[model samples]
Target: MASTNAPIYDELFNVLFVIGTILFIGMTALVIYSLIQFRRKPGEEGDGLPIEDNLPLEIFWTAVPAVVILFVGLYSYDIYDRMGGMQILSNDMHSHHSISSQEKVWGGIGSSKQESNTSRDFPINVELTAMQFAFLFNYPKGEIISGELHVPVGQPITMRMESKDVIHAFWVPEFRLKQDVIPGQPTILNFTPTRTGRYPIICAELCGPYHGGMRSTVVVEEPEEYDAWFKKNSKQTEVEL
Candidate 1:
């Protein structure tokens, strides 16, 4: 469960959870108190005090939640920006900029200029294709694999993904990464795996009847081991073709 964005997402979730708990408890307490304290007298009951609206209380209730919601929205946006969500703006703004022939554009959004200039040493590039019930992964070296994605630990990996059929979603709960795979629209997700292990890749979209079965695994391995795995798979693919 080690990923660059996991902590940020966790922090956001904690904030929301705490606020929701406080609101629930406070509201419940007020409801129960009103039921007991404002209940009808034992003998007679025509009407309770002609309660008039208190401007301060009304304003407090309205303004407090409004402020809380505003704060949460801003905080969530900041966290999302830090997690590379702002890359969408970068891509959109640079959509018409000239790029090298070596660079490719998938669809709606492509890599930003800054992302295109990423060093070749790390940050391996990969393409993902989503269909009805499976994910297809293509490595930088023209190797194609299905059912699992592999990358070296501690190195950033950028995935450019699109859907082959209807809309789909790629989600890895541990990585705190989830992005829509839209038909005719390409999207990108970048993350660095900090640990070596296997984690599930789940389709978080309701695409079809078998959507629940659309699951895969991501394997993070040591650099040398990942290289070995890649070479072995590439050679096996060559033989099959």
Candidate 2:
């Protein structure tokens, strides 16, 4: 499935991969050149000229990696912030402001109605409960489904997840989204699927003996199709319950 976050992840991967490949090739060439040029030939080696370190060479090596790391760090942080990693900090700031201003925070404490409404515009909210070897999804309208998550294409989806027993991870590789499901601490993942298809959901964390079995499917469909499926499933769930 095409995802909103897929391009960001792909760009980051391409940057890192290019940098790594260049570094590896350069280092290998340097090693080979040094070995061939400084070989012990004709008794011309006396402790390798006392091995004096050059300040320029030392500075170059140190500064290059430092700069590269700084750039990558800032770039990754931008991506993380865009993916809602900074929501926690935003919550804290809102909390502080609410206390200081003596004004009730709209939509409840640690909640931003503006931000929520913006991100959740026509979005489907799904609650994911992680257990030993399975995932259960609950829709906002009280429909529950096991082993499958259904969302409408071209609309936003917010998954609020929590673990029942231990820590688990919700990962959909095709969507380039993953979030930890911690016990007693809820987490949210917001994404909009651009394509309509069935994709796999994987548990990336080692939660239990059957962690390998923690797998499910996400079905993205058109709005009308999704509505029909949801209504039919809701009725079936009501009948079963």
Candidate 3:
């Protein structure tokens, strides 16, 4: 896992896999047992028994599924809450006065409830725009624009993203973070990259005929390296401006 959030998702997946495997094996065993124990006799082919309703069996089956589903629902909800999925968007998102012309605020995976209680520095904010076949990243602080994303390791990153034309998705599998970029609605994605390496950024949603080509790279680097890169890029941006 390259990010802190990946383990939470992986744990959820593991739990689901274990539950599914147990159910599959148990059901297969029951089928095999029924075939052997309740099959027709060698030469006697008559209506053996007329069983109306097995009340206990019915209750067992229904209760088992219900309990299992309830457990899953609660478990999934907890995971989502931990990932900060329960953080609702602001009510004024649709109001034109609340946001600037260049950006519209939409809620997404933010800091978890637990994280919200702790005192921490603000995350590095970057604006991203997804077009038909490209992802553009802009660092508002430095007035720098880049085709690829660059960030320091071990720090929180908040991506404010939107789509220029159609719906697209920003997905970084290693970090276990994905968010849709809707044309008129901006969204945010928060994560702390723990590994210092290059990771692929893919558009998980199909937006256009060339959706497959909408790809970019996120370069996670040491704090010093990132600072140097940022300074260099910002200077160039200044010259261009």
Candidate 4:
């Protein structure tokens, strides 16, 4: 599973787990206790009273459970707020963009949204195009972008992804993140890989015959090491292709 750096999410989850276990045990005990204490028989006297309407007990169960659920909800919301993120990027609010005199009309690059533009700070921009059977990552040169993606640990990397033929979902189980690559529409998914290890990146959708085999590995490494690997891979990509 994707690891989380947010301690509050972990703490809230632990509290929830504990409460759930308590609730489970309480429900089980209630069942067992009722089975034993209220077992009906002919000789039973004043024991088999029908509890069709116990207002106090009903209110107790309802209110207590509601309160517990409220606690969980409030705690979860607090955690989400703390873990959300920096506002340099958002659903709205972009920098004023414009086409350069040179590469004029590259669409959104120099579009009017360039004022508060979040795309500019994406350390290394990656264009991920998903086709029927594979995901091709493109990195433009003269700007230090490369085909083989290399990321520094704990830095947010945005993958500007889209599809050529059909919709495909990009997911990494270890990071617990997924986003769909839709045709004619670009999707931006930004995530920072905190762990230094190789993780599996798989297409979590059924696209075609090779859908199951459409998988890749994202290798996270130290900042310096990542730079070295990027340099090596850039050379290799040109020499090979």
Q: What are the per-residue Cα lDDT tens digits for candidate 2 across 88-183?
A: 422333221212343221211112221334333344667789989889998755445646998888677666677899999998988888878878
Better of 2 and 3 by lDDT: 3
How accurate locally, in lDDT, is each candidate? 0.75, 0.72, 0.81, 0.62
| Per-prediction TM-score to the true structure, in the order listed | 0.83, 0.81, 0.85, 0.66
lDDT of 3: 0.81
TM-score of 1: 0.83
Q: Among all windows of ten consecutive residues in candidate 2, which has the lowest summed lDDT?
A: 105-114
CA error at residue 78 for candidate 4, angstroms? 4.2
lDDT of 3 by residue, 1-241 (tens): 8887889988999999999999999999999999999899789878878889999999999999999999999999898778877776553422323256555355557455323222433467688999999999987777789999998888777777888999999999998888899888878777888899999999999988999999999999997798778888884544211
TM-score of 4: 0.66
Residue 76 shift from truth in candidate 3, angstroms = 1.2
Clashes of each: 0, 0, 0, 13
Q: List runs of model 1 lying over 4 Å from the truth.
A: 89-120, 236-241
Worst 10 residues of 3 by lDDT: 113-122
The positional error of residue 102 in candidate 1, measured at the CA in angstroms, is 12
